[model samples]
Target: MEIYSSLGIQAGISIFSHIFFIGITFYALQAFRLDQLFKKGRTIQIQLIYILLSIAIGSSVSNFILDISNWSKQLPYIFT
Candidate 1:
């Protein structure tokens, strides 16, 4: 079915894009050695913050892509 095929394509693209975004974000953070800037116990907190921020950024980017593709009418609803 055309509908099912299109859905599958979109899903695949979304997953791949998210992985790429998160991977690049982590790579950049690691390259900066952000952990070294924090104390031992604080490293965990910083890592958590970095990861969440990366996800938030990735989600926003993906939402923007979806909007540009005209896949959905509404803007991203969260964190507004």
Candidate 2:
């Protein structure tokens, strides 16, 4: 029961972290003028690309943060 509770909490944290970072990535992406790199008038396609890119970058960053956190929590075991 305790393990299941811990797992649920971790899952919730992971989901929240991914969503938060993805939003940040999307906002940051707005500063780029991607029109020069794609066909003109392909607004829908460009938006889709932005979504995919944001997920890619955001998930990577979130994973890195989570891994670092998990590692830090385990550091004390190295001396034992």
Candidate 3:
């Protein structure tokens, strides 16, 4: 029960952090005038690629770490 509660709290924190990171990324992009450097069509394409890559990288990294942590937590019981 205690472990479950800890996991829930960690998950919530992870979600909040990801959201905050994405917000900061967009804010920084706009502040830097990155959009102005590209032609209209290229800008849209670049933005789309940037967003897709961010989601893919973030999801994989987060899931991999979470899975490793979960495995480590189970290892003690399995070994015993």
Candidate 4:
């Protein structure tokens, strides 16, 4: 139960952080009106691709950052 609780907290934090970044990216894209510049049919396609690529890249990046931060947390124990 304790382990599950701990894991849940970590997972929740990771998910929220990822969502925050994804939301911000979409917000910025909207602000720049990037989708409006494309042809009508292609606009939807481009937006889909953009969103998928962003999630793929963003997840990898956020995982890397989380790993690094957790690595620091474990550093002291390794030396001991």
lDDT tens per residue, model 2, 1-80: 99999999999999999999999999999999887799989999999989999999999999999999999999999999
Per-residue lDDT over 1-80 for candidate 3, one digit per residue giving the tens place of the 0 to 100 score? 99999889988977865665555555555545556667886977778766765566565666666678778888899767
Specify the highest-TM-score model's number: 2
On lDDT, the candidate that comes out on top is: 2
If both were scored by lDDT, which would come out higher, candidate 3 or candidate 4?
Answer: 4
Clashing residue pairs in candidate 2 (N, C-alpha, C atoms within 3 angstroms)? none
Local accuracy of candidate 4 as per-residue lDDT tens digits, 1-80: 99999999999999987887777666655556556668777966887867886687677667778899899999999878
| Model 2 misplaced regions, further than 4 Å | none
Clash totals, every prediction? 0, 0, 0, 0
TM-score, every prediction = 0.65, 0.97, 0.58, 0.72
RMSD of each: 7.2, 0.6, 4.7, 2.6
Q: Residue 11 lDDT in model 4?
A: 94
Model 1's number of clashes is 0
Quantify how close model 4 is to the true structure by its C-alpha RMSD in Å.
Answer: 2.6
User: How many angstroms is residue 41 displaced in model 2 relative to the true structure, after the best TM-score fit?
Assistant: 0.7
What tens digits encode model 1's per-residue C-alpha lDDT throughout 1-80? 99999899979988988888877776666666667768887967988978987788777777777667763444554436
Quote the lDDT for 8 in model 3. Answer: 96
Q: Global CA lDDT of candidate 4, please?
A: 0.78
lDDT score of residue 55 within candidate 1:
86
